[model samples]
Target: MSTPARKRRGRRAYIAGALAEEQVARYYELRGLQLAHRRWRGSRGEIDLVLRDGDAVVFVEVKSAPTHARAAESLRPAQVRRIMMTAQEFLGREPRGELTEMRLDVALVDGQGVIEIVENALSDF
Candidate 1:
């Protein structure tokens, strides 16, 4: 049950998220990380980006807003937990399995399109 306006807003959010992911992906690519997967999802949750940085795997969560602080604040603790769980699921399915080092990172995109990457944003459980 949805109204046209709500549907439109949802579509706009999806487009914004897609743009943010693309911007963040390019930023990582320029730094030599290969794109392992984009929008990796499991029953646990969805990870915005999964990248291989050398021998380590980087799981990224991208947030976009009018300001960096706003974008950073958009991520909830529950969401992080889900992302971490999804990351575990992703790793278990990988060919390398749990052999590689893994890290969680966050990428914030501002309205002006500036990209900021926060590395190792989460501590391992």
Candidate 2:
């Protein structure tokens, strides 16, 4: 049983997430990366943004919260695994397949809409 208030909150979160993704995409684009896909979904999971930097593929996970640190902390280990799996699925479509060079980045958006990009945020994964 979903209440009206709950639905409204869910809608608001969705909108905020969408906006954060958009902001992150623009941030990368300004830095010379070309947007390849937005909200790319695979059997494993969804990748918020996929960009191309030369021949390298950059998979970005966008997070939004009251603070940048909170946004960064929101990405759990389970989600990291899912993102990695999804990234591999996405790479399967590339010309080099799984051999394609790639990196995972986390983009954190604060309440005021400021963006902070953590490059290679999941290098150890």
Candidate 3:
């Protein structure tokens, strides 16, 4: 049976998500953070992009929205909880040892080519 048009649109949406992630990763790298991983997964959840700065590992969440408001709203409380859980898992698996100095950062990509970055957007859970 042929897949419906809706399913095809969903697949396209997923691909766009990947492209936005790459853009955000590059944006962070340009700002001097070392790129560690993208779409990094742990048992708890997935971190969109993770970067290292000296001794600190920063867990990043990237939101790509057709509108600025939509992008900012993507960081709902429940979503933050999942990212926090994933960060804990990442720390436990880190070979570098010290994970106490880590923080969470957020990147929002508006379809109009505007990018908003927030560091320490949310307090550790």
Clashing pairs in 1: none
Off by over 4 Å in 3: 1-3, 95-98
Instruction: Please tell me which model should have the higher lDDT, number 1 or number 3.
Output: 1
Off by over 4 Å in 2: none
TM-score of 3: 0.87
TM-score of each: 0.92, 0.95, 0.87
User: Residues 5-65, candidate 1, lDDT per residue (tens digit)?
Assistant: 8999999999999999999999999999999999988999999999998878999999999
Tell me model 1's lDDT, rounded to 2 decimals: 0.91
**Top candidate (TM-score):** 2
Report the C-alpha lDDT of model 2 over 24-116, residue by residue, as the tens digit.
999899999999999999999999999999999999999999999999889999999999999999999999999999999999999999998
Candidate 3 shows a clash count of: 0
RMSD of each: 2.1, 1.3, 2.5
Each model's number of backbone clashes? 0, 0, 0
Each model's lDDT comes to 0.91, 0.95, 0.84
By lDDT rank, best first, the candidates go 2, 1, 3
CA lDDT of 40 in candidate 2? 97
